[model samples]
Target: MPRRAMLRSAAVAGTAATLSLVPATASAAPNRWTPEELKDRKRVLEAGFTEAEADCWLLVVRATAAFFALPELHPLAKPEVVTAVHVIQDKLMMRPAYRKYRAANP
Candidate 1:
């Protein structure tokens, strides 16, 4: 499976399994990424993305990255790509704003 699909599926499975453990009033929201972090993600997606789809694509990237475990370094991609993607995803997942947003939105 594509990384994004795998992440999304895992998130769905996790949420379903944990639903009973959460308070009824709790909310789920989308994670936010920093401008710099977004820029890097944008650049990666752009390499294979069309201009019209950039915003939505970046959103998916941020969302998927936020939920999934960071991928380990791959031999094919540059070291920076792996490192940057991991950092961006980690930050998105851990940010206070993201947690709050998820609580409010989801």
Candidate 2:
């Protein structure tokens, strides 16, 4: 896998492990990955994406999921929410998490 992919995977695994402690109904508005996201992932993979590319796509999808998980989002404009979500997502899915995930998964 690409360096970025490894890092991203680590972050995802770490974040997921942490989040797993929370119940599905932990929040009234739990972020759910919709069926459309599954379809989109499949589409990306079928288009002959490299592993890193697919992981990048996963980051986007996961970020959207995280965005929905935020309770303060409803008060913001759509564009603002999008910007905030992406920014936060980037932070959460960076090298530190990636390293942790890679160590455990490997």
Maximum-lDDT candidate: 2
| TM-score for all models, in order of appearance | 0.25, 0.36
Residue-level lDDT of model 1, residues 1-106, one tens digit each, is 9875565555545543553343332232113456775676567454544332344335545445554555655543334344444554454444545646788998
lDDT of each: 0.48, 0.54
RMSD (Å) of each candidate, 1 decimal: 13.9, 11.6
Q: How big is the positional error of residue 71 in model 1, measured in Å on the Cα after superposition?
A: 17
State model 1's lDDT. Answer: 0.48
- For candidate 2, write residues 38-95 as lDDT tens digits: 5765676666554444454565566566767767644534445455445545654464
Report the lDDT of model 1 for residue 24. Answer: 38
Give stretches of model 2 more than 4 Å off.
1-39, 83-106
